[model samples]
Target: MLGLTQSQEKGSDDTIDDLPQWRRVIPVALGLCLAFALALLFVLANRAADDREDALGNQRRSYEVIAIARNLEGTVARAESLLARYVVSVDAKDGQRYSDQWRLAGTLIENLRRSSRDDPDKLRYIGLLRDSYAARGKTLNDIALRTTYDQRLGALGRLYEANRTRDADRIQRILTVIIGHEMKRLNERSTLLDRSTMRADRLAGSYGLVGVVLLVAALVALWVANSAFTERRYARRLADSEARRVDHLELAVQNRTRELEVANGRLRTEMEERAQAEESLRQLHKMEAVGQLTGGIAHDFNNMLAVVIGGLELARRRISGRGDTGGATTNVGTSGVGTGGKSEHGRDTDDAVRHIDNAMEGANRAASLTRRLLAFARAEPLLPAEVDANQMIQGMSELIDRTIGDQIHIVMEPGAEDWRLWADRHQLENALLNLCVNARDAMDGKGTITLSSGQVTLRPGEINDCPGGDYVRLSVRDTGHGMTPDVLSRVFEPFFTTKPVGKGTGLGLSQVFGYIGSCGGEIRILSKPEQGTEVQIFLPRSQRSGEREASRLLTEAAMAPAAPRRSVFVVEDDPRVLAATVAALEELGHHSVSCDHPAQAADLLAQYPGTDIILTDVQMPEMTGPEMIAQMRARGIALPVLFVTGFAGDDAEAGLLDNEHVLRKPFTLAQLDRKIAEASSAPARGHKEAAA
Candidate 1:
């Protein structure tokens, strides 16, 4: 019995040794399983992240492509608009702008091509868009070339034809298709991104649960082992390792999220920049259109004012016995003048004359307003001459007093005696008058307006954009309510006014600004909330003694005897203007022959080869007056030409006939007589020279 008991004890000891080995194996196996699970989860998570990133990248690319396509459409539209304006204005700047915008469109197309390189379908659309844009670009180029060659009418016609044909529409449609395709791709990628994110979330949750289960299994296995203490230490070490792996996964996710945020920030910035560019383009277009519109309306308005002013002056002369009948029968027509001899009712005639004078005053004021509009549009033809600022202000003092009313006081601070400037004298007077009127309005017609002038030497950056030079500074300061910073900043903007509607035209300051700029000068305004406003006009100093020469010419013309009667061929388009001009010529003691069309003027001149002078309108249908004159010169009919126009376009077009004399419409009889004398006395040019 002792030997058997010893044998059982030996077997128990061997089993015990084997049990310790099993405990080590079980814990090690559990740790290995946990490690494999964590590694596999990490790999899966990394793969899911990569897939999401790819989806996001695709979405971002699609958005970029879409934005580019939209911008390309807008660029093409802007280019076409500029081309139309170029045709209308015949401006070199507008033509250059069109070319720039078209080139920018080409660049956008290239960007679209690059963005769509990965998609065969999108690439095909881009190719189509490119071809269409190229075709349109060629058409626009032809129009611009025509305009550059001075074929404005032909260019305008072609532009209208292109619009009717919807050439630009094809480009728009192609862009729409491109944008739509990108949007679809973007939506699909977004859906994929959402699915990937959800899958990653689910995988993470599953991996976390599995890891927890594995951790519990490892702890239970360690507790069940024979050598629990050593096994527990090993299990704790495995748990720590698993936790570190989880930390590593979380860190990688945070890094990816930060990268996404940075990319999104860049995208937002790009979108904002694009928006700002679009807004600036829109503002430019709006201002350009407004200027063109203002010019057109002012042109037509001037023509009507000519008829009114001319008719009124004719009526006044007849009633007041100022008409130089010169023993010739007067044919006044429907100009509110009687065809009989002087009326015996002298008092009634005096009343009639006074009424006509009042009418003339109002008509002249309307004409002045149109001149301001033309000036603002940069379309007025400026006849610049040397001017003495002090003399001009002195001469205008009385007119300013009468214009500003008795309540407002006028203070004159004349500048140097030799402070002369080269500018349009009449326009300068109008500018001063406008400033005085604005001051009077600002002060509610009851404040002191100091009109000061002096010679100033300006340095670079010393004043409002005036170059370093000697300038005649003319200031109009008023003790009135001043302007805020916001109002002051925009004071020079056209059609911007702080006054109530109808109280002001909003063009007072704008006209001053444009006129000053045209004279190669600068204008500055200084104002405070309650300190009153001061407007300073800096006109470039002229070296010539224009004031004395101008006075001499005026004295000579005014003192000179009446011109001899001669045959005047008047070429006018409007019948009313034609009749009014004929009456004025007759009133000036000259025989007048009238033709309503420029095309007929050449034939009429040939028929009346004894014509002493040619009086023609500048702009007419079928042919311009200069063109007709050229034709006449071609046929060896170079009688001195006098151009009559209400709106003579810009300075370049106004001076088209360099050798010919120009007489603005809405003229007084004296002005008409003076211009006629000037035209007749201007040495006639040979046909060859005139045509050239």
Candidate 2:
């Protein structure tokens, strides 16, 4: 899931199957060309426009200077017209005023001549004309200067008139020269205009070319837009196809998920069935081992019993016959009866009897030990009940503390009154005691053991490495020499032990494990060497009321015989146990036949049809006891078979005990009697099918 999130953020696509190679290059090339061409065109047009603007400005300035010269001449002529006509001729009558006027007119005419003198013809004519006018002006001025009589006045007047006429002729010559020059200049200007018109035509041609390029660019832009639209259409199709592929992929994934779910469900069912079959096999194997061990123990006990019975009978008969040994009573006091407690010889007899009684007591203890071993192996049914776990701890506290000796202190941390658990009371107690003993041994009986109980609610997905459920937890904590990591790692392994020889039976913890597992509970251990150790047992809550009621019935049954003895056919591959079971059944007042295999018993059943029940060892090398029974039932033999098993590999013996008539290894004569009676009291129940 995290990987999926990261992949989404990175925009990774799994589906890009068909992409065109050419689609990538066209747009990139087109964009670069367009940009470069546009930049180059802008630079060229800007330079051309700047050059044209400069040329036009220079031509306008030249025209403006010419116009300024023409305007100055007109201004002077207007002023001359006003001065000559106005003022009532006051300045005309005065020589000085007249001289000033003539000087102004001469300067004005000189300026006009010079301004128009750029043309070669105009310069020569204007110069000649100016010289003629100067001479005329001099003549007139001389006449005006004359101081004579009337004749002289008349002469002076004639000269003035002649000079005036000459000046007029010169002025006309100057006007003609100026006008010709103006006309020649106008022709030159027309030539310049013709050149400008040619340049304008060339400019118009270039502008038309620019307009054509602009039209081409517009057309290219339209084509590019159309190409882009086509490309967009192609891209849209690709996107749509990719989207459809994704949808198909999603649908396929959903189908695969459904298939996977169905597979998982089938696997779960198979696993449950496998577990039940495995457990049954384990129980059967345990029962077979028990049968062998029980036969051996029983055989040995029976031999001892034979010696005792024979010796007691011989002694009784000898006493009844009144046989006296020589001086056997000589140690009796002289008063005919011993008064000093007893004579030395008499004390010896009493001592022999005590030894015999002690031997019998040891035998009884061995039988009791056998019963417990069988119970742990699951040969017997569990009696479950609602129990205050804290109270149970309190009840067992003294015994557990005593077992560890005074070196270790045992503490009971009782939970509040609300703490309750449902389980087999005896089995639970045994499990707790086993843990306490294990803790005590780990501590070498010198530390403290605390037994505590509590209830816990588990949330979903929180397993504590155990299956999730409402559980009552009973924990045993010890301040003993704890287990190292290496030791702890394999602590739960069957037959694993660290204790010195004869100090421990490795079955202690294995039994606890099996019992808890069988009850749908779990056990966990935590330990660190030199620090401490704690073992927690978690049992799921039970809601069934029958377990509680059944518990009471079991307790009462344990007190007395709940079954009656009947004829039994005991089948075993081991000679010792077969003989022992036969002997034990005989002692228990039942008719019994002993065989080394269920096959042998099968033959007997065919021949006699008188065997009331079959008691068989489960794990035989040739054929398992359950398999033998299955074979027998197939053959129409209807006798019920009770299995006898040992605690070894009890997990493999569960199937044999499913018949509810198995006796565990090293059982007392009483347990064998009970099982045989249970088998004979009812018609044989059919074999249970393996759980599906």
Clashes of each: 0, 20
Per-residue accuracy of model 2 over 435-486 as CA lDDT, tens digit each = 8888887877588888988888766446455766678888999998788888
lDDT of 1 by residue, 1-692 (tens): 89988888988887777687769798788678766765676567667666766776686677668667766766786777777766655778988988998999999999999988999998998898889888888888998999899765466567656766866599989888888888888889879978876775666556546545655776643333323234334434543564465466457546655754665575466446434333333443455578789889988887888888888988887766667656434433223446454454655766777888889889888886677677656666777778888888887777788788999988999965777889987778878888888888888879899998898999987985678998899999999999999999988754467886446545568768877898899999999988899999998889776656765686477436653677999999999889888988887778888999887777777778678988899889888888888787777787878888877766667777565678877777778877777777767766466566
Backbone clashes in model 1, listed as residue pairs: none
* Stretches of model 1 off by over 4 angstroms after superposition: 1-301, 315-344, 376-378, 386-420, 425-451, 455-470, 478-517, 524-533, 541-559, 650-652, 655-660, 686-692
Q: What TM-score does candidate 2 reach?
A: 0.37
Model 2 regions more than 4 Å off: 1-361, 364-406, 412-445, 452-472, 480-518, 522-534, 541-565, 573-576, 647-650, 681-683, 687-692
- The best candidate by lDDT is 1
RMSD to the hidden true structure, all candidates = 12.6, 52.5
- Give the alpha-carbon lDDT of every model: 0.76, 0.58
Q: After superposition, how far is residue 281 of candidate 1 from its true place, in Å?
A: 7.3
TM-score per candidate, in order? 0.56, 0.37
In model 2, the worst 10-residue window by lDDT is 81-90
